[model samples]
Target chain A: MATITRVGDPADPRVDDYRDLTTADRRPDRPGGRGLVIAEGVVVVRRLIESPYPVRSLLGVPRRLDELTDDLAALPVPAFSTSAETMAEVVGFHLNRGVLAVADRAAPPDVTALLRDARLVAVLEGVGDHENLGALFRNAAALGVDAVLLGPRCSDPLYRRSVRVSMGHVLRVPFAELPGPWPASMALLRAAGLRVAALTPAAGALPLASAGLAGERVALLLGAEGPGLTDEALDAADVRVRIPMAAGVDSLNVATAAAVAFYGLGCA
Target chain B: MATITRVGDPADPRVDDYRDLTTADRRPDRPGGRGLVIAEGVVVVRRLIESPYPVRSLLGVPRRLDELTDDLAALPVPAFSTSAETMAEVVGFHLNRGVLAVADRAAPPDVTALLRDARLVAVLEGVGDHENLGALFRNAAALGVDAVLLGPRCSDPLYRRSVRVSMGHVLRVPFAELPGPWPASMALLRAAGLRVAALTPAAGALPLASAGLAGERVALLLGAEGPGLTDEALDAADVRVRIPMAAGVDSLNVATAAAVAFYGLGCA
Candidate 1:
């Protein structure tokens, strides 16, 4: 059973893991950073509890803690109950979510392993926008993608905003940085016997549904919003596929496109 | 040919239409409101110039103005060029896009007239969130949705953020409020010979793709992100469809779900 403790002071040493959260969460994955996985609100906190990461503790007001009592009863972690003001002062921001949980960052999964056993894996390059990154994970989780493979220049998906925006799916979805060359890193998916399809809006590109991806093991390569996949990345792909859009239209938001593609691939 | 005027002062009365954009755009369609449609950036401004709405004026920096010279050359409207700093001061925030355009709200196309010819349309209810409402329009446009019909409690699509998020497609795609009794108002679409398909995550929903929506003229009913379609609205729909998300997952974001359904309807 988890230990429940009452903490009145905002500056208590025991709750340091929850201190100055806004600043600390900025570069949790950077050098000299703790890289803690933080989950906010009851739903996300519940997700963090169930994830593979090791949870250190939790801080929240009584009402939130009371709501989570059943979940806490099953966890072995400590739960600190405090006032909202104290929680706000401790975290340097009024966390409207009422509760926060922090867990240690787990190691990246094996790329070949994830690809070999996966039906649909999203391969991303230069998708640096945190919100889009988070939304993509949420879609990936909802659409039943087996894994997400990170390409070059992608943001750390564990960033707090991404974590929150993803509704904590960033922690649930297995992701690993594609640890090799730029465009050539794509060969890893091919070697694992998965077709690599780059999503583009070019006129000559084959329509997504007809790209022969339905029921195939596919690693769909996605890029940042405006400057989509680089030329080299496009050429490296086994084929280029487009979501047929109306004429004279700008592209759909990256995450939205990924959701449609995921639905098309996953459900087909 | 459009008249080109150079304004050096931030407080020029000629550019008053562009002042206090953050607040001015809060209620662009309400009582005593300016009822002006504003588009930001060159891309959107260009779209505004091309939309059915009557262009009131254009305020932009020299570079953006220069980029639009070809389009401007064909118009009789005034294009006011100003410094970025001056434009920023007038706009109540940093004008990073360096351009803005304002136009009168065009009279919406007759609801019956729009439905008469539309192969596909989106009917929204309680979609008060501006960004979602805007993203829905963008999705509708990308999927070649014929028009949008607002049922009730929907936000103004011409709001500045909506216009921006819709990538100015809000100006292109026609949307009209569905008047008359709440669910009964749906008969207008039925009168237009379009079948109304409501989307929900309820267990009884038919998976979108297998529902035979493709190759059919249909109207899709959508709702706010959290609450989804009202019971009355659901009852009014001819059929209920779902995206078939994984078990125990919350429903997809309203706009994302709409996109999947729209594509599933084979609008492309």
Candidate 2:
């Protein structure tokens, strides 16, 4: 069972992991910075406790902590109970969610093992916006995509804003950075018998429905909203497909487009 | 041609339409509120210029205005040029997009006329969040949804945030309130030779792909993310369809789900 500790002083060093969280979670590569995974709100905290990440501790008001009593019962970490005002002082902002949990990122799953029996996967390139990245994870999870592979220039899916925007699905979905150089690294997917299909709005690409990806092992390549997939990545894919779009309209948002393509791929 | 006038002071009354925009655009129903349609950034501003709404005027820095020279050449409204600092002072924020345009809300298209020749439409219920509403509009425009019918508890599509988030699609795609009482109003869509398909996450609903809606004229009924379509609305629909979702996951965001359904309807 977890231990509940009452915290009153905002300056107490015992709760340093929960202090100045805004800046503390910004750049994990910075000196004295640990890339800790943060989960806010009761629902997200429950997901964090259920995730593979190692739980450090939790900070929340009494009411929120009581709500998580079942989750905390199995958690071996300390749960800090504090007033909303003191909690806000430690976190550097007024958190409306009333509860927070921090965890250390676990080692990523082996790429070969993750792809062993996967049927549908998403390979993202240059999707740097945290919110978009997070939302993509949420869609992938709901749509039943097996895993996500982060290509070059993709933002950290574990970023705080991404975690929140993904509704904490970033914690649940399995993701890993694609190893080795650029497009060549994608060959690993082919070795595991998956066709790499790059999704683009280019005029010449095959339309999504007619691409015949349904029930096939596919790794859909997606890019950022504006620039889209690079020519190198496009050239590397086994096939290229596009969602038929209305004339004169800008392409759909990246995450939304991914959901459409994921559906067309028949992952669900 | 638009008349270019240089303004040095933030308090210039000529730009009153652009003053304290954050609060100014809040409630169109409030006293002294005009319910003006606002467009931000170069792309959205150009969309506003091309829309049916009557342009009041434009306020922008020289560089952003220069980019819109071709657009302004065809517009009759005055263009107010100001420094970035002055623009920020008037708008109550750092105007990073560098341009703003205000337009009066045009009368919504007649419901019968909007449904005429339309193959796909979205009917929204309780979608009060401006961003979700706006993103749905953008998705609707891209996925070739021809019109939107506002049912009830929906926010103003012309609200500034909705306009911005829709990428100005709200101005191009036709929409109107569904007339008559509650779910009974949906009879209009059936009268127009369209199927009323309610989108739900209920397990009993037919899965989207197997629903056989492709190439069919469909009026997809959507609702807010959390409390989805009311039972009354669901009971009234001719058929109920759902995007297949993974077990133990919440439903997709309303707009994303709409996009997937719109794609399934074969509108694009």
Candidate 3:
């Protein structure tokens, strides 16, 4: 069971991990940065506790903490109970959801092992927006995509905004950076008996319904909303598919497009 | 051609329609409200010019107005050219998009006429969030949904936030409020030769892929994220279909789920 500690002072060093969180988690890979995985609100904090990442501690108001009694029962970390005002002071902003949990980042899963038994995967390229990346993870989790592979220029799925936007599915979904040079690294998916299907908005691309991808073990390559998949990435894929669109419409948001492809490609 | 006039002062009465837009557009239906339709950014501004809504005038920085020269060539409204600082002062915030357009709200298309020739449609219930409402329109446009019917508790699609978040697709996709009492109003869709398919996460609901709705005229019923379609709404539908989801995960965002259903039901 977790230990409960009352923290009245916002400056206490024991609660330092929860201080100035907006900037603290921005670039954890840089010097003097702590790469802590943060989960905000009661629901996400519960997910952080249930995730593979090692939970360090928790901070919340009394009422918010009471709501998580069952989730904290088996958690061995220290739970800091504080006033909403003090909690807001420590976090550098007021959080409407009240409860929060922080964890240490875990090593990503091996790509080869992750793909060996996977049926459906999402490989993202240049998805630099944290919210889009996070929303994609949430969609991936809901749609039953077996795993996610981060290609070149993709945002860190573990980033704070990404974690919150994904509703903590970033913790539930296993993701790893696709190592090696750009499009060349995608060969790993081909070797694992998965077809590499790139999603694009090009007029000549096969419509998703007619692409014959349903029920196939496929890796869907998606790109950012505006630029779309680079020519090299599209060329490397076994097939290029598009969602049939109305004339004069630009395209769907990247995450929304992924959900459509995930459903169309038989992820469910 | 638009009449370009130099406006050096922030308090110019000619630009009253574009003043303090954030609050002015909030409750346009209330007393003392102008009830204007606002479009932000060059892309959305161009859409406003092309839409049925009568463009009243435009407020923009020189650079952004210059970018819209071709769009403004046929427009007869006043174009107020101002510095970025003056534009920000009038709008009550920093206007990063550098352009704004206001138009008179046109009468909504008749619901019967909108449904008559529509092949695929989306009917929304309790979707009060402007961003979600807007995003759903963007998805609807991209996925080829022919029309949208706003049910009870739906936010105004012409609301400024919805217009911007939809990338102005709200202007492109035809929509109207489903008039009459509650779920009973849905009978109009049935009379129009369309199936009323309510989208839910119920376990017993038929999977979207297996629902056999592809190429069939469907009016997909969607609700807000948390409390999905009311029981009364669910009971009124011809069928209840769901995007197959992984166990332990909550439902997809309402707009995202709609996109998945739109694609799965063969809007593409």
Candidate 4:
């Protein structure tokens, strides 16, 4: 059984990982910065417990801790119980979610290994917005895209805002940064037998439905919302496809577009 | 030609319509509440000018007003030019978009009239979240969805947040409230020779790709993110279809799900 300890003082050394979350979250080089993945709220905390990451501990209001008793029973990690006010003092802001869990990052699965037996995957380029990145993973997971390979300039999917917006789905989807040089590195997928289909709004591209991607071992390539894929990236793809859109309308938000593409090419 | 006037005072009665946007947007019953449609930023401001809604006036810093000079040249409306600092004081916040336009709410197009000759339409129920509702319109417009019929429990799409999130497409695509009763009112769509296809995650629903909705005159019914479609609504539909999703994953965001459906059933 996990030990439960009451922490009355915000300065308590044992609860140091829970301090000044707003600033600490930005200091990724610090203990809780990029070094640790932080999950807030009960739903996300549960996901952290089940994710590949190693759970450090949990801090929550007494009632919130009580709600996770069953999930904590098998783990021997420390669970800090505190009043809402004390919790807020340590967290820097009053978090209405009432609970939090922190964990260490785990080794990302190998690219070739993850691609093995995978029929559908998303290859992302320049998708630097955190929320958009997070929502993409959530959609990918829901639509059954096997894995995500980050090309160049993608943001950290584990950022707090991303984790929250994704409803903890960033923890569920498997993602790894693409190894080697940018566009040249894409040969890795082709070598692994996945066809690279770039998604664009360009008029010349085939409509997603007619592109004949749904039944294949497809790796959909996506770019940032505004400045879409670079010329080299588009040239590298086996085929280019687009969602047929009405004239004069701007492109859909990046993540929304990705979900549509995922569903279109997703396995039935 | 539009008349341009220089305004120096924040409390000037001429700009009262633009006051305290944060709370002012909520009191839809108040003078500027539901009575007016407010468009912020140059892009949306331009859309408001092009929309059927009658533009009453505009407030902007000198640079932004100058930018709108060509679009405003033909309209005989007041354009108040002020400094950014004074504009902020008047609006009760820093209006970073640098321009604002307010227009009177126009009469919603008749339901039967909007449905005429439109091959694809979306019939929404309980999609009350403004951002989701707005994004849905953006997707609908991009995918050539002809119109939207708001059923029960839906929030006002003209709400400021919705307008911003839709990137002003809510102003472009036509939407009208579904009149008469709840799901029973859907018969009008049937009368218009359109099939009512409800989207659900139920096991028995046909996969969207295999449902053969493409190229059909279909009104895709959507519910809120959680609770999904009501039983009465589902039972009333001509056919039930679902986007195939992976096991253990939660349902897709209501708006994202709609985009996929729109693209799938959209004209080639």
Candidate 5:
């Protein structure tokens, strides 16, 4: 069972990991950044407990902490109970969700290992927005996409904002950076028997519905919202598919477009 | 042609429509609310100019206004060019997109007229989040969803934030409130020769892939993210279709779910 501790002081050293959270270097690549995985709210905190990340501790209001009693009993970690006000002071913001969990980042799964037996996967290029990257992971998880392979210019999926936006699915969905040069690294997916299908809005590309990729192993390559896929990435794909959009309408948000692709391709 | 006016005063009464924008009564329904539609940034401002809504005027930095010169040249409205600092003073915030446009709301399209040739439509219930609603309209426009019918508990899509988030597509898509009672209001869709398909994540719901809704005239019923459709709303549907999500995962964002359904059934 987890130990329950009352932390009345906002400056308590026990809760130092939770200090100045809004300004902390949550970025994965910054110098001196610890890349601590922070999960906010009861839902995401519960997911953190179930995730492979090593749970550092949890700080939450009494009500929220009580709600997670069953899950807390199974884990051996300290649970800090505090008032909503002190919790706000410690976290540097008023988190309406009332519960938070912090964890250490875990090593990503090997690309080869993640690809073994994987059928539907997402290959992201230039998905730099944290929320978009996070929402894509949530979509990937729900739609049965086996894993996510981050290409160049993708944001860290474990960014605090991303973790919150994804509802902690970033913790559930295994993601690893695609190593080596940009488009060249995508060849590894082909070697693993997954067809590289790039998603573009270009009129010349085949419509997603008629791409004939259903029931076949596909790595749906997605780009950022405005600029879309880089030319090299589009050229690298074995097949280029478009979503068949209306004329004069701009492209869909990167994450929303990814969801549509994930569903159409995964169902096939 | 729009008359260009250089506004040197931050407190100019002529720009009252753009004053204290961050806290203004942008809500259309509230008393004392002018229900003025606000479009921010160069892109959305341009869209506002082209929309059915009557363009009131334009307030922008010289550069953003210069980009819209061609569009503005045909409009008979005042264009106020001001310094960025003065614009910030009037708007109560630093306007990053550097342009703002205000318009008077136009009458909604007649429901029966809108459904005449709309092969794919969205029927929303309780989609109170402005961003989700806006993103849904953006997706609807992109995926060729012909129209949207709002049911009970829906927010006003013409709200300023929705206009911006929709990438001004809300200005393009035709949406009107579904008249009559709550679930019973949905009957109007069937009478118009459209199938009422409610999207739920329940176990017994038919998987979207196998529901055979493609290419059929479908009015996809969507509820908000958390509670989803009410019992009456679900029963009122001609069919209950699910997006085939992985177990243990929560539902997709209502807008994203609607996009997947739109693509699946719209292309059918």
Candidate 6:
């Protein structure tokens, strides 16, 4: 069972981890940053409780804390209960979802360990946008992709926006930064017996479904939506697959396209 | 050719349509509404120029206006050039992409016309979120989806946020409200000889790929992420298809699911 404590003062030290949240948890790369993982709302908080990260504490309204009773019973942690007004004051904004959980970041897994048991994985290059990274993890989790390997120019998945946008799937999906060098590092997947397939909107690329990828151990490479796969990244793939889009239409959002490709490759 | 006009002051009467854009345009459906269709950024502005909606005028920085010179050449409307700072004052927000266009909405095409030409159409129920609706249109356009048919609890696609999020694809995608009673209104598509298939995650629903949807004319029925399609709507469909998601996960975003289904049914 977890300890439940009532906190009324907005400046209470017990809830220091939850204070002025907006400025306090700015990305570690930003100034005045602590980079703690903040999960909002009941669903994401539940996920945070279940995630591998060590829980520091929780702050929420009584009603939301009441809703997490079953989850709280399974974990040993301190949960601070307060009114919505105090939570808004301390968090520096009105969090409509009513509850929040903050956890320390865990060291990311190694690329080799991440791909060890994975049959399908996503290889991302230049996916620097936070929401796109979060959405990609959400898609990867839902579509049966076993792991995610981050390439150069990708944003930190633990960024608050990415964590929230991913619905905490970033906490569930194992991800690792590729170690060696750009494009060359991708050869590691090939050596592990996974075929490297790059997704591009290039006209000559074979249609995704017709690329002979169904049920194959595959790593699907994707670039950010606008400036697609860097030339070197495209050259590294064993095969290039296209989604066969309409003329004059721009490419689909990076995460949305990744979902389609993930579904096609995983279901195959 | 468009009449070139130089506007030196933010308070100029000619730019009234673009004034207080953030506040005035947001509640266009409320009591003091001006139901104007506004398009922002270069890409969307270009789409607005080509859409059936009548372009009233243009407000842009000289650089943005100059980039649209060819597009302006074919239009007889006023093209007002001003500094970014002046444009910001009128809009009450920093205008990135630096251009804005206002168009008057035209009567949507008849539903029968949509059904006659469309091989695949999307019918949305309770997709009240504008960004989801807009992103759906972008995907629909890319996947060669014919038209979008709105059912109920939807948002106005002409909203500024929707326009920007859809990358102006809303201007290109043809959508109209389905007439008659709620779910029963769907019968109109069947009456037009299109198969109405609902996408859901419930057991007993055929897996999308194996549902034998390819080469068949399909009108995909989608609902909001949480409530999804109502029992009435599900029962009305000729068949229910599921995307075969991993267990314990929520459904895919309605638009993303629609794209995968659209692709499965063969966009061409």
Tell me the whole-model lDDT of each prediction, alpha carbons only: 0.89, 0.92, 0.92, 0.89, 0.90, 0.88
Local accuracy of candidate 3 as per-residue lDDT tens digits, B1-268: 9999999999999999888787788656675457798999999999999999999999999999999999999999899999999999998999899999999988999999998899999999999999999999999998889999999999989889999999999999999999999899999999999999999999989987778787779999999999999999999999999889999899999999998888777643
Which candidate number maximizes DockQ?
5
TM-score of chain B of each: 0.96, 0.97, 0.97, 0.96, 0.97, 0.96
Sorted into a CAPRI-style docking class, model 1 comes out as medium
**Tens digits of per-residue lDDT for model 3 on A1-268?**
9898999999999899988888777667766457789999988998999899999999999999999999999999999999999999999999888998999999899999999999999999999999999999999999889999999998888888999999999999999999899899998999999989999999989988788777779999999999999999999999999988879999889999999888877732
Task: Show model 2 residue runs off by greater than 4 Å.
Answer: none
Q: State every prediction's TM-score relative to the real structure.
A: 0.96, 0.98, 0.98, 0.96, 0.97, 0.97
* Fnat of each prediction, in sequence: 0.72, 0.88, 0.91, 0.93, 0.98, 0.65
What is the iRMSD in Å for candidate 6? 1.4
State the lDDT at B35 in candidate 4.
46
For B51-150, candidate 1 gives per-residue lDDT tens digits of 9999988988899999999989888889898898899888889978988999888788899889888999999999999999889999999998999999
**lDDT of residue B15 for candidate 1:** 90
Candidate 2 vs candidate 5, lDDT winner: 2
| Candidate no. 3 TM-score | 0.98
Tell me candidate 5's fraction of native contacts, as a decimal between 0 and 1: 0.98
Model 4: per-residue Cα lDDT at residue B14: 95
* DockQ per candidate: 0.73, 0.78, 0.79, 0.78, 0.90, 0.69
Clashing pairs in 4: A28-A33, A28-A34, B28-B34
| lDDT comparing candidate 6 with the true structure | 0.88
Tell me the docking grade of candidate 2: medium
lDDT per residue as tens, model 1, A101-129: 98888878888788888888999999999
**lDDT tens per residue, model 4, A55-142:** 9899998888999999999888999999889899998989999899988888889999988888899999999998899889989989
Candidate 5 TM-score versus the reference: 0.97
Model 6 lDDT per residue over A148-230, tens place = 99999999898888988989999898888988889899889988889999999999899998899877899999999899999
